[model samples]
Target: MPAVQEVEVVVAHRERATLRVGDMFLKIDADPERADVEVQAMAIAPVPTPEVIWRKPHVLALAALPGRALGRLGEPSAASSTAWAAAGAAVRTLHDAPLPPWPGRSLEELAARLDGECEWLVTNGVLPVDLVTRNRHVAEAALRPWKPVFTHGDLQITHVFVDGDEVTGVLDWSEACRGDGLFDLATLTLGHEEHLGDVVAGYGADVDLDVIRAWWSLRSLLAIRWLVQHGFDPSSPGCEVDVLRARM
Candidate 1:
C-alpha cells in the first residue's frame, strides 16, 4: 500500500476538529456521545450521507460525498435555483421518513432557551434593546405546537452537498432528531432568503412562511452569543447579525 497521507485540518476548535486526507474525512469531537449520535443518525437517515469508514473513540472517519457544499452561510450561493430545489426535495424526504428514536427539543424547551438567550443578549449589551424585543416577538411565532418529524437539526446550507442540480449528501448529523420540519427549512434558508421560493416549490407542499421567518429570528438570536464566544464574527455582512438587523 502507498504511504499513509498527511491529513489537512479542515476545521479545528476546542470542541471538535475535522481533517481531510485524500477521499476520507475525519471528525474528532470532544464528546464521544456526539460521535455516536452522528453515526446512528447517518445509519438511519433516508437521504444520502457520507459513508462511515471507521470509528475510534472520539474520532470518526467517513468517505466524502461526491460534490461540493451547496453554499456557505453569510454569502450569496452560486448554486442554481434547481440545486436549491433539489435540496428542498431531499429535506422533504428526510422529514417524511419515520421519526428517529430520540426526541429533539420541544417547543417549550426551545422557547425557554430563546428567552434565556434574549436576556443574555440584552444583559450583555450585545444588541440594542429594541432590536432584541422586536425579534423576540417575531420569534414567538415558532413556539407553537408542531408535529414532530425527523429533522437535520443543523441543516445549514454549508452542510448540504450538491452535484449537477442534485443533492448528493447532507452532513453533520449529530443534532438529528424528531423536530419541526419547518425548522429545517428555516435553517437551510437562514441568510439566503431569496432562495425560499425555490425551496418551497420543491418541497411540494404549502409552508407557513411566517413560522419560517420566526425560526430565522429565533435561531439567529440563540446563536449570536455562542458564535461570539467562539471567536467568530457574527456581525460580518450577511452573517447572523446581519440577519437580525434585516428584521428591523
Candidate 2:
C-alpha cells in the first residue's frame, strides 16, 4: 500500500487557496480566468516554469519544481549572485518573447489606481500622510508611456526557484501579460535593492535606475491595502511598507 501524503495549505484567502499534497500543488482560484491565463502563459513563456499536471474548472494542479525558492520577500536570499543573474537572464528572455495577446493596464489606469490606493492609505490612516505623499510623488515617474513586452506581471521572489546557481523554474503566471519590461525588472529587485546590479548584469542591458526606483515606490504603495485585507503584513521587516518607508 502507498503511504498517504499530508496536505499542506500553502496559501489561502477569500479568493484563492493552494494546497500541497506530496509533489503536487493544487491551486484553487475563484476566478477561472486567472487559472486559464496561468496555464496558457506557462505554455508560451520562454523561461522554465512549473509543469501543468491537470486542470478542472477553477482548480489547477502543478508538478513541483526541483529547487528552493530564490527567497522570500522579507528575508535575505541565500541564492548566489550567479543564481540571481540567471533569474535575470531568464526574465530578459521572457520579455523578448512575442507579446501576449492581452494588453496590460494603461498609464491612465495605473495612475488612477495609484491615486485611489494612496487615498485609501491616508484616509484609513494606514500610513503616515507624509510617507504616502512622498511615494505618490515618486510613483509618478513610472506612469509615463512604455512599449509593451511579454511580462511576468507578478514576478515576486518566491516565484523563482534556483538550484546550484541555475534557475530551475518560475511560477505564478496568472498575472502575465503585455506590459513594461522595466516593471518586471523592478518587481524582481523590489525589496532586494542590493541585487539590482547583479540582475542587470545578467539582463545584459543598461536600464534607467530612476524608473526602477519609481516602480519600487509605486508597487509598494499599490500593494499594502490588498496585503492587509488578505491577512498579510506589508509592514514586516524588508517588506512593502519598509520599501515605502525607505522612500521617505
lDDT per prediction?
0.92, 0.93
Tens-digit per-residue lDDT, 43-125, candidate 1:
99999999999999888999989989989987889999999999999999999999999889977889889989999999999
> Cα miss at 108, model 2 (Å)?
0.6
TM-score, one value per model: 0.96, 0.98
The residue pairs that clash in candidate 2, if any, are: none
lDDT of 2 by residue, 1-248 (tens): 98889999988999999999989999999999999899999999999999899999989999999989988888999999999999899999998899988888899999999999999999999999999999999989999888899999999888999998999999999999999899999999989998999899999888898999999999999999999999999999999999988888
Name the weakest run of 10 consecutive residues (lDDT summed) in model 2.
100-109
Off by over 4 Å in 1: 1-6
lDDT of 1: 0.92
